[model samples]
Target: MGFSTEFNSICKFKSARELEDLFEYGKTKMRKSGFRIYPTGMKVIAFDPENRAVAIVQIKASIAEIDFQDREITLVEMDLVRPLTPEESAVETALAYEMFFRDHESN
Candidate 1:
């Protein structure tokens, strides 16, 4: 099947305050920094104790395929990075995906 040209939404677990601010302006920032490694960027569907708020991220079409298909090869924070296990990293996104769908279905 053909794929979507851009991401419509991303699931993130935000602090109540963070969520409030996002909705306040109807806009949010998704930088390539502070999370998984994306040579360009990634839209996370994350809901661990740390992630925050639902976001709609638009990945550039040039990199979307890899961003969508690749896993973190390194954990990133600011300019610092550390190695990661691909299989291990999947859990958070997997869990987040489940939560996203569950929430969607209930609505």
Candidate 2:
């Protein structure tokens, strides 16, 4: 199965190079996980490996306009809030574990 989520705001990175740099920064800050680009190539999600935090970015069509341009990376507009608390992570982890086991059992 696949996962889906709804975002209220969009972030426009100047170019793919800029997006890559942002992913690298997230990897270093989280220390355990990196970023994930969706198959559609329109969204990117970064999260802490331990489930402590998550940041999702939806690329705007304007990206295509600058796809070949070189420019500095910037988080044009972001609405994602702070990282999750330990308790929140715990609950999410539990639910994820349950789903994994249940899915595997049926298989």
lDDT (10s digit) by residue, model 1, range 2-37:
323223234333345434444465433332212242
C-alpha positional error of residue 34 in candidate 2 after TM-score superposition, expressed in Å: 16
* Candidate 1 residue pairs in backbone clash: 13-51, 13-52, 13-53, 14-52, 14-53
Q: Tell me the RMSD of model 2 versus the true structure.
A: 10.9
Among these predictions, the greatest lDDT belongs to 1
- Give the TM-score of each candidate: 0.26, 0.29
lDDT of 2 by residue, 4-107 (tens): 32241223232445445545553221110112222233554333333222446434322111223443222232223334466765665456446443453331
